[model samples]
Target: MSDPNANRGLAGIVAAESALSFIDGAEGRLSYRGYDIHALARHAGYLEAVYLLWYDALPSAMELAVFEGTLAGQRELPAAVLEVLGRLPDASTPMAALRTAVSVLGQVDPEAEDISHEADLRKAGRLVAQLPTVIASFDRIRRGLEPVAPDPELGHAANFLFMRTGQAPGPTAARALDTSLLLYLEHGLNASTFTARVVASTLADIHSAVTAAVSALKGPLHGGANEKAMEMLLDIGSTEAAASYVDKALAEKRKIMGFGHRVYRTEDPRATHLRRLAEELSVESADTRWFELSRAVERLMLERKGLHCNVDFYCATVYHALDLPVDLFTPLFAMGRTAGWAAHVMEQHMHNRLIRPRAEYTGELDRPWVPIDRR
Candidate 1:
């Protein structure tokens, strides 16, 4: 048998090839479409980065205006999709609801299977355009509230917040949401993006590939960690409680949610930016309760596990302050990640590999058949 440690956790696995983002986990660095994540978070809006992810460069002035116009154009779902949204149970999870809606979208736009570059770009535009609508609609439906109409005057992030809350978000909340979306836009070969590429490699339709990705990303380890981080903080209750919780969790060898990452050994680059957003939102509100709880957990996790929070840690509090539902956190993740997935899909199709990998076999060798009585 091969050495067990030979592939510990599949660490350093080169899952796919792409001209997308590169993550230096050891250095806590991330870049998208060749721009540092810090710069993008500081300056760029979410849709701009999405354009870059798919098109390989930032848009020109006229291109930016045109792209924004296109996104504004497709903000409403067809009546059929809204009907499905109406039937979803109020208790349904957002990822499940989103997965269902994504499949249902195939029925609404039956032409989404067109794979030529021009055709794919059109579908990409539609998906990007409709994502906010789907998310906002699901948000209200699950909360027993009616979905609000989209406002074309608002930017992407502002429109999303406005649609969810029935009022305009302040500049600070809107910017934070925009940065959060940019931060979530891409990472190097994450599970869901890889899943999308795998399906795309098989020559499936883009909708089918994306649908596969949504299913893969539903796992707590992949996209649900942010919601889990919030739950952990509420369960901890206080700074004093945090210490005890850390002690017991460490003694039992249990993972503290949001404490460790598969890629980063020192810190998560995305966490740095999200931490700033959490602090900024706290400053804007002058309420530090959630921030303090998060800090306590961070301190305890580092002291106990020598690990730091990933993007999901402080983001929980940010979303909480925004009054977002816990279940929707991961779907929000998908809304942002769709950009990266689209980019990777284009890359996979252009450079066309089958993506077939061999498993290291360690099973019973071939043997002659025996009668049941002899066995």
Candidate 2:
């Protein structure tokens, strides 16, 4: 039998270091490149956050505008990739199609084999730019709707919303999404980010690294939390049932998808901002039902379990208020985290080292092999 005390998930293992993001789990503090997440979520656009993560500094006004333009220009998917998306089975999950599309994207990139810093950076930019297109295209194709072309006039988050719904998002909705993207920017060596770094360590192209990361994030324990949280609230249906729902879940020893974090002993800092945003958008749209239910569930969870909600909890209501389908939640998460994954990929390639860890042996020490035709 395997040793029960081994680091089953490599928890607390510091595999490598980079100047990416910091999380003070004990105090519920998070910052990216020395900037607090709260400030970024409130004041920065998603493009700015992407630049900061990749370049390690905030860009100037002209520089940011140039960055945005470059990304916008590259948002249109190649014809081959679009054909592939259309060819996929209609019932394919968004994440499954996204994973395949990203792989196909690598296959089509002329510089897919290049690992130099300059080439990697260009590919990274394309991943950030084209991911929204890939997602929106697959979604529309699966639903029997024509994919919308990228709108250069719109910012990154706003363009994604436009592509999804075929309508330009207003300032409040646009800013709300932009803030959420910044807030989801990155965390230190989470599963998907680590997966990106690991793949990049092999000198894989940025698209390959990003594809691996998306696959890792597709797991229910990771990226699916937000979707499950929304399902929970939707099932609960009202603030009146929130307490009982939580109570029953707790009494039955069911896992509450959004309450606990593997790293944070306190509430997730991102959740604080998302909680406010969820309510703001809810109130702005004159539909506070989801927000109220979220609050009630949050209060009950904290009171009974002494657990704090993570980023996924309030994000459910926030995305729901944005009128996003619950099924797209994880894909949206992959969309946000792709920037971070690319950043990690670049960092790993710059200081490449194969992340080969040892596995503990718990089987019999010297087992004699049986002959194939033993009597």
Candidate 3:
């Protein structure tokens, strides 16, 4: 064991490097591949960003068509995978179901373990393209309804919303969801991606790496914060309730979910975009009550803890407006992040090196063990 003051969380540690995305926490800037996040979120669609992340450049018109065609083609889940999904409990969390499904998929695909550039890229594309469909399918099946098939005519973000609700999404909602996906798509060595790289460094298959990443993401401090944020909103009934409730929670030293971050001391850049989306969606839906409550909490949190809301804060409101369940928030994160996970897996494999880190020992050394009977 290391010393109690060793900072076991790896806080302030530089673990890895990447050229895919850059986050300057001090400057509050985020970029994907080479594109500015604000511009990409505002203008480029989700599929367009995914193409850039996976291929390392923006796609031309012809390339975009072929890329989207490939994604549309792979949208359908295997019947065997669907059969397994049907057996899962309805109350089962979507993230758990997603982890199981991704693992099960590895069993069904002969090339699931392939990590070659040519082979893995194809596999990555399929997984990335199918993520939204897979998440939607699990959500529908568990609710005792047939999964809605993906609509080829729909754009990536719009198709996902349509799959969940079986209706065309409004332009504003569609854009909000698309931007959210882009925001969550990639980050530098987050817990889940680190888990993925560690597994891939062992020469494990991409499916195994992704499965590990999913498991890491199940933690509350990570991908599950959005769900908790919604819960916090429901707990505090209104804007009036938010002020007192926040005070009590802070007095108890409880972490205000959707606020603060490990890396970004000022504010999460993604949160700025999501906050704008939440604010817009609130106006667009004419449901400003939740928005009011959220803002009240944000103001109090800043005053009390000097902490501001992260992406998960307003994202909860955005998802709520779209009628998504609270529990599905993190799974939605996983769906958006599948592309990044795959990209990270490819990066780890390209310059394949086993990721082995040393721990500073603090335990008793060379102690003789007493026989159990001696006790």
Query: Which numbered prediction scores highest in lDDT against the true structure?
Result: 2
Instruction: Mark the 10 consecutive residues where model 3 has the least summed lDDT.
Output: 1-10
Which pairs, if any, clash in model 1?
none
Counted clashes in each candidate structure: 0, 0, 0
Kindly list the per-residue Cα lDDT of model 1 for residues 97-133, writing each as its tens digit. Answer: 8888877886678576667777667777777778888
The TM-scores, one per candidate, come to 0.95, 0.97, 0.96
Clashing pairs in 2: none
Candidate 3 lDDT over residue span 143-230, tens digit each: 7788899998887888888888788899998898888988889987989999999998998988899889999988889999999999
Q: Considering TM-score, which of the candidate structures 2 and 3 is the better prediction for this target? A: 2
User: Global lDDT of each model?
Assistant: 0.83, 0.89, 0.86
Task: Name the Cα RMSD for model 3.
Answer: 1.6
Sum up the clashes in candidate 2: 0
Report the lDDT tens digits of candidate 2 across residue range 1-375. 676776779888789898999988998899999999988888888999899998989999999999999999999998989999999987889999999999998999888899999998898898889989988888888888999999999999899999987999988888887888787779989999999988888787898888899999988789899999999999999998888888899999998888899899998999998999998999899999999889998888889989999988888888999999888888888888888888888889988899878777666777788999994
What value of lDDT does candidate 1 attain over all alpha carbons? 0.83
